[model samples]
Target: MTRHEETGAALLSVLLLVAVMAVIAATALDRLTLATRIAGSAATVDQGRAYAFAAEQIALRRVGELVRRDPAKLTLAGDWLGRDFTLPLPGGTGRARLADANNCFNLNSLAAETAPGRLSQRSGAIAQFGELMVLLGIDRGEALGIAGAAADWIDSDGNDGPLGAEDGVYRSMQTSYLPANRKMADPSELRAVRGVTPKIYARLRPWICVLPVADPVRLNVNTLAPEQAPLIAMLMPGQIAIGDARAALAARPAGGYGSSVRFWEASSLARLDPGDIAEQTGVTSRWLALTVNVTMGDGFLTAESLIDANGGAPAAGQAAPAIVRRDWGESD
Candidate 1:
């Protein structure tokens, strides 16, 4: 071969080798970048989870202290109930809020018994919820439909509620899902029940809650505020008007109404015909809702928990606050 041909061939081979090395180098760099991102993402998520846990612990401590300090003085107006906590985390920030959950209408109140989904023959909660709808000015038929459907969803019995549908109605839908046949896990579940339009649910959302405890919960009269007057009106039915409810609510002592008797005596409720008023309302709070929001890097995580102040049955020689429920959710 000619000398020029030999040299050119050698040059071409070297060029090809360099190109291959460059390609390999580029791929390795790309993989390294991707792996670094994955590791960083994983670390951020873990940090978020840790922040959430810390927030829960803080809430538990605060709530436990409040409940233990003075059971009688616990009320919705307590500074701790509506306060917000912002914590600085290593890589992000965590925020938490504790709210008075017991003062609201518990959707689980509609359930008759604590066992999954058994309808009660005598639970007044369903009637109270129906009355709430009436006061909200919802169409009577639609309101009844929502209450009845909610009852069927929670009750083990196949009995139909007035204007409510049975499993048959749910099964006929295009999606074809069965009735929960259990207590609602969240107030959002109401949206799934028939006749609960978004608008209706929105109106009711502020006043209602779905507690993990299936037993009926009495409204906290001491914590009840003027904005919550509608609930009181419903509680007393014909006996208490909304203004009277607010009047009674405002008259409560700073610490609280102190007891059902004190609550009855301080406001217009003083004229409640004098019998079993505690059955409908009380000054004590049983449950509180805590929410934690953590922002780590570009991602977000939110956790909600229900703290039972009544200190649920604990093992012998132990005093512990009940964390009734914990749920991961998104900000609305």
Candidate 2:
């Protein structure tokens, strides 16, 4: 218990202090390294997003040129309908594809535009949708029920169709959510409607779209692929079979029909009664979608832009086609 003992205890204390300081320094260094890594990842994501946006602009410009070059007809003559291309960016790369977005059945068509900002159940469109479901292998009664439910969901009324549900019915469900009673902004909303099982949704996803308008479906016949022939068949239910529709599309001229009349005149489509469908078919597309994917370092970015080309010819100084909507994070 003398000076030696005191000195030994002091030495032990100094070693313990050194070990504690070393642990603290190590922990601080680890946290700094982690923060620096997180910041780098964020910067990389931002760069990728920037590249994706640039690619979208380029796609829009190309679409503008295409529409201006030929306002009357937009054909697959140059393989532009589903064109895939790539762009090189500094320290990254961008991939993009342009597609005719109006070739599918517009789900909003279930609701007819009676007047500006007014909507009602569109019986004809509902029938067509049901026909489409039947063509996709769903039972006819089930298809009609699903179509009625979809119409009720968007029709701006509380009265439900015979096979559909309204707010009262929805309120009685286990989950308890009311009908939107408005046009859907995305086709995914169909999942919320009654009778639309996940399996049914998967079957319908590829052939349906939710355009931003309640107008009846207007399909560009020239852009319809063989796989999309069911859309044509649905327009003329009980007349043109799906196989015949595909045959009609297969027989389409490489340069595309000069007009909807020529399209209907095709021998393969002669069985289709053009009743009101002629007004719904066209050679020009009104909507196009651009999907861009960017890869930067360890990050990835995806974006989709919906362009409405209903604007008159850009060559005439009318404002070029407008980008009505843009979505980031995922492409549908």
TM-score of 2: 0.91
Candidate 1 lDDT, 175-257, residue by residue in tens: 77777777787888888888788899998888888887676657777666778888877765456778887888888777677
User: In candidate 2, what residue range of length 10 has the lowest lDDT sum?
Assistant: 310-319
The CA lDDT of each predicted structure is 0.76, 0.85
**Stretches of model 2 off by over 4 angstroms after superposition:** 1-23, 312-317
- What is residue 205's positional error in candidate 1, in angstroms? 1.8
Where does candidate 2 clash, by residue pair? Answer: none
Evaluated against the true structure, the overall lDDT of model 2 is 0.85
**Prediction RMSDs, each to the true structure:** 3.6, 2.4
**100-202 per-residue lDDT for model 2 (tens digits):** 8888888899988787767799888999999999999999998999999999999887998868889988898899999898889888899999999999999
